[model samples]
Target: MAWIHLLIASIFEVVFALGTNATDGFTKFWPSVVTLVAAAAGVYFLSLALRTLDVSVGYTIWTGVGSVGTVTLGTIIFDEELNAGKVLAFVLIIGGVLGLKLADRKSGTTQPAEPEPAPVSV
Candidate 1:
């Protein structure tokens, strides 16, 4: 559930980023409103995820997701640069996110397995 919230929040981050760009330095009213709403939602979801996940790991992933998504969106929507180095950076960011998830899972932080009780002799 927390992971789901995080994923949604990450996507909202992208929306917020684009909304801000469209706002044109706050000169645009509707885009600014949309940007504010999306930013709020993104923070809300991030808070939800933080309730269960470690702050260090969760926050890092949150920012990474947002950054990667924003860069990709910029390239596609804004015709921003998409050089090989940028592509490589995107791959590295995604790999790091996956690594963090795996690390958390390995640490039994995501969902813990129940421990067996000690045998009791009468």
Candidate 2:
């Protein structure tokens, strides 16, 4: 469930990034609205996912996936360059995200135990 939320958030992150580019510094009304909405949605979903997933793991994956999506879409939509270096970076980012997921799975989702109250004075 958390993973699903994270995935949704990541998609929104991509949309937010692409939409920001189209906004032209918020000069365009519709694009700016879309960008702001996407940004809000991405953060909201990310917060939901963070309830279960560790901040370190969840945030990293969100940004990593978002970056890859943005670049991939940017290339197609904006005609941005897609050189070997960028491709290599994407591969590395993806590999790191996968590694984090695997590690999280192995560790399992166990919240820390709450500390007990100290004994009352006599």
Clashes of 2: 0
Residue range 42-69, candidate 2, lDDT tens digits: 9999998898899989999999999999
Candidate 2: deviation at residue 41, Å? 0.2
Clashing pairs in 1: none
TM-score for each model: 0.87, 0.89
Error of 2 at 30 (Å): 0.5
In model 2, the Cα lDDT at residue 63 comes to 100
Most accurate candidate by lDDT: 2
Distance from true position, residue 4, model 2, in Å? 0.3
Question: lDDT scores for all predictions?
Answer: 0.90, 0.94
Candidate 1 residue lDDT tens string, 2-103: 898899899999999999999999999999999999999999999888877887778889999999999989999999999999899999999999999889
In model 2, the runs with Cα more than 4 Å from the true position are 109-122
